[model samples]
Target: MLSDHDFLRYSRQIMLPLCGELGIKTLAKARVVVIGAGGLATVVAPYLVGAGVGYLRLCDDDIVSVSNLPRQWLYSPAHIGQQKVRVMAAQLKALQPAAQVEAIPEYADNSNLCRLMSGADLVLDCSDNMTTRQLVNAYAMDAGVALVSAAAIGLHAQAAAFQPSLCGPHGNHGCYRCLYPIDSQRAGNCQSEGVLGPMVGMAGCYQAALALRILLGDPNVPWSQLWRLDSTLGEHQLLRIQPDPSCSVCGHVSHSNASSDDSSIPNSGV
Candidate 1:
């Protein structure tokens, strides 16, 4: 049940069809782990907190650089030398005091991925690199947790949601590896290739919206689907992600919910 204060704070969202008092309550108890505190995460954290997510675990070991100021709205020129996680946490708390935000000042690697995501109800892959995305995807499969993965490069962005447990006995749909073959050569990154400032912001907001629908138990938006945005071209598209039976990460789960298609966007950089 929502308190009088919560009802007032989230009245608009509470009135939505799939999201009512029940949804608002779900939001109040969901624990979300965001893997990166960069561009995608910079926008993701605030929206989750503002929307009333119960707990947010922010992990990033990188430091802010003067060049990151343009797209990473959470940071300012004065915070160039600060840790991204701590700075992002402070800002997230300021957005919603009722939310508990933890700042883990370390990168997500094999050694710490499990600990960082031990109790996460949902994992948001707002990370900038494929390595981290792969790690998170593997963890999600093993933990039986849902994941919302997204990435943006130059003018293009792509995102997908995976709910292995929700996919029924067929197992699960494809994952990050299904989209980007693991053994493939590396792709460009923001440092080497330039990315439009708003591109990532658009992707982050899209991911946040999908995440909220999942958190609220809404199936209208659909998981195991891929969405792509071309901000420069002023357009977008949605397609089904084919689950690969050979994928080491999610192979155990079979997903026959929809026809398999190639919906992966080029990995220029994020």
Candidate 2:
């Protein structure tokens, strides 16, 4: 049911064997919620919009700052001091007026996370902080929505997809908490450790690819795969992760409680 304009707009993507008319239709109908309008979002939003995602909800409370210019490519010098969501939403609309773009000009906290994520087909965590990533993961798991979590610092980046269903009938695929372990410590944030702009873009692109695969119902791509790219070492690693028996989030016992109290997970200070 693609319109003439849509057919023309997505011709190149549609021509690909992995993404034909069916994939384009899936992309057009997908509703995605992206948390963070910073470095990763710069690449993700535009690609999603261009690919014709029906609805895109953007959440970011920060404003465009001069310091963010190096990594956040969506903003221009003129957009300095403008609200991140507002400016990014405007730019996305300009790129694809057909896509529905909602700008939540506030930080996504426990109070508003449910509202922001309600009815979303998928969620993308592009935020720099580990706390927000955990929050988003918890909420997505609770809502039974797929989540694509990604992070990049310096020349290193990691991307993973979490689908609750893959946790198996007994809740198998480990949750974010299982992967990081509540007691584990994180390094530092990109700001503190310094991140290369292209590295962030590379991670974001990987996230987008996985998100598209999920939307397209590609059975070959599992929901528990982790892709790591280290430009520093010129290495790309793909790890197959399984659910942990004692995971605090998606474990058999945790599934019954649906608790958000991950206080047991130690903060990595990232």
Candidate 3:
């Protein structure tokens, strides 16, 4: 059902083994929700739109500032006081007019998360703080939608994909809560710790890749595996995340049968 323009515009990716015309069409019909319009969303938005995602809902309550210019590529000096999602939506429209990008100038909190995430095929948690990430993860779990999350600060970055359906009684995937249950323990945000521009950009790129793979149903996508990168050292590490039956967010009575042995998490260099 691709128009001539769409086919021609996306022919390069359509010819790939993993992403044939079917994959491109799948992407064209996908509805995605992105949390946070800062560093990661700036990079993730353009890629999703350019690759033909049918719709994208961007949620953020922040405004552009001089400090964000180094990593957030969507804004400029003229957009200093403007809302982040508004600026991002305009730029994304310019990238691909056919894609429907909705800008919600609000944070993803208890009041509006259900409305924002309803009917989404996938959710990207690019939030800076643990509180928002935990909230988004719970929403995604209840909705049975996949969540791709990433973070960057002080030259180190991490990205992962989670599907709540894959974490029940017979499932093996882990949710965001399982990874970092205590919000007080996870601190270093980009604002206070400082981050290199390319560091967040790299994390964003990984997030985009994971999002696309999930949308395309790529069997090789590293579900629930945390990818860690050190930009300074040019090193990459992959950590397998185990499902926690005792997890406050995704745990259930039947899930208690899952292995809770946290002793042997496989680690490998990439």
Candidate 4:
């Protein structure tokens, strides 16, 4: 049960038809793990906390650099040499003192992946590189957890929500590997390219939206759809997607409808 303060603080979110009191309470019990504390996690964490996600594990093993300040909104000159997760952890506490936010200053490699993701309700891949995305995808597949993956470089951004248990017939609803099978072929990253600050913020917010919808069990959401945003050109596109039948990560997935228990909102076509 939410205290009066919690209800008052999140009244707006609670008022939404999709996320009413029940949804808000569901969010309050949700546990989310975010990979990367750079541009995306900085904003994503705050949104999740603000909306009352009960617990959050923020994972990153990087340090704050002068170059990262332009996009990472949580840090300043004083935090230049500090650990990314630690600094963000403090900021998240300040945002919602009651929320439990842990700064796990470790990279999400195969060695620590399971530990990092254990008991997580949702995982967000806000990572900058393809390797991390692939690793996260494989882990999410094995754990049978939903994943919201997004990446932004320059003016282009791509995001998707992968719900393995919610797969559709005709081989629909694939993981990240379904779209980009080979890491060698999936090109472009922030390191090799320039990106606008709003671009990361934009993509991160979209990722947060998808995670919240899943947490709330919003029945109308079109799970496993690829959303592309072009901030430079002011264009956006949403394409329905499915897990690759031969995907090494989710190849064994069965071609059956999701359990009837899953919630869905009408595809608003927004």
Candidate 5:
């Protein structure tokens, strides 16, 4: 039951054909967990809260720094040196008082992953590091929760959704590990590679869109597809991906049900 204020607050969204009163209720019933309260989370958390997601759990061990001000819009100059999860949770609560927001100011590892993902309907990977991303992917897949993963470096950004049901049918529907196998060699980090602020925002917006679609149960969304945006070249690419047959993470009979093992990496066909 939406309050009078809620109906008015979400009237425009509810009026849409795909998001009527029922869809709004669904959104209100969905629980989402977001890893890394930085770049992507800045944009994603607000939209989900504004859309009336029932519960939002944010995880991040880092504190707000001056350098993050350009892209992390949730925090202000005054919030510098404050814990990211705490600040973000406060901001989200401010936006939607009716919604529940929790802050976990600790790194999400195997130990806390299960508890973090316990009741979540969906999870968003907004972390910048590959290790954290892989952990989130594995945990979400193991928990049978849908995952929306996004990454950005420089002017390049990629966003994808992984639904457990889509993993077995096609090799294209894979997890982060399938796309980038963990080896001894490490790739570029945001600190070393440098990232454009808008690029992160662009990726974050796409992540939010996918999360909304999953929550609203919109069938038209291609959940297995990956969307790549290269603002540097002014190009956008959409690739339909299938699961990998021999993926280390998703393969093996014992872990056959693990959706995290699926992976696909987007490269510009241009």
Candidate 6:
């Protein structure tokens, strides 16, 4: 049952046909792990927290820098030298005091990724690099947790949801690795190609919306479909990602007695 305060706080959201009292309750019980505190996270975290997500674990090792000021709205000139996770946590707390926010001042890696995602109901990959994204994907797949991934660079942006468990028995949606094979090095990121605030913001907003839809068990949620946008051209495309049976990350791992190595995979700019 929602308390009087919660009822009032979320009155607007609860009024939506897709998100009634039950959806609000479900969101309140969901545990989410966000893998970055940069541009995408600056938008993703606050929305999830504001939506009443029960617990959000924010993982990032970077500190606020002048270069990030333009896109990372969560930080300001006063927070230039502060750790991203710490500053982001404080801001999220201020946004929604009822939401539990855990700030982990470290990058997601093999040693800690598993532990960081242990009890998460969902994982959001908002990291800017391909390495961190792949690492997050592997861990999420191993834990059978749903992952909402988004990235943007230059005038292009992309967002997708990889929910293996949520897909029915015959669902053939692919994991992140399946979509961008380990051998590919084509992803461009903000640092390399440069990006406008609105481009990154668009991807971040889509990630937040996708997360909410998944938590509410919305059947229309696009699983394994990559949403691509070229803001400069005013074009958008929804491409289905066909699972790769030969994929070493998701497919070949189980059939053969071997562990998949992701170290050689090139860095993605996103």
**Ten residues in a row with the worst lDDT in model 2?**
261-270
lDDT of 6 by residue, 135-241 (tens): 78766766678999999999889999998553322456787888886533455777777899888899999999999999988989999899999988999999988
Q: Identify the runs in model 2 with alpha carbons over 4 angstroms from their true place.
A: 168-171, 183-187, 253-270
**Model 3: how far is 103 from its true place, Å?**
0.5
lDDT of 3 by residue, 210-266 (tens): 999889999998988999998789899999888787876666523212222231111
Ranking by lDDT: 3, 6, 4, 2, 5, 1
With candidate 1 superimposed using the best TM-score fit, by how many Å does residue 190's alpha carbon deviate from the native?
1.3
lDDT of each: 0.80, 0.81, 0.85, 0.81, 0.80, 0.84
Candidate 5 residue-wise lDDT, 113-207, digit = tens: 77877789999999888777877776665666789999888889999998765664343476656666673226555766888899889899999
State model 3's lDDT.
0.85
lDDT leader:
3
lDDT of 1 at 135: 74
Clashes of 2: 7
Q: For candidate 1, write residues 168-200 as lDDT tens digits.
A: 335445666766666323565676677988888
Which run of 10 residues does model 4 get worst, by summed lDDT?
Answer: 261-270
Give candidate 5 misplaced runs (Cα > 4 Å): 169-172, 183-185, 253-270
Task: Estimate the Cα RMSD of every predicted model relative to the unseen true structure.
Answer: 6.1, 3.9, 6.5, 7.1, 5.6, 4.1
Summing lDDT over every window of 10 consecutive residues in candidate 6, give the lowest-scoring window.
261-270
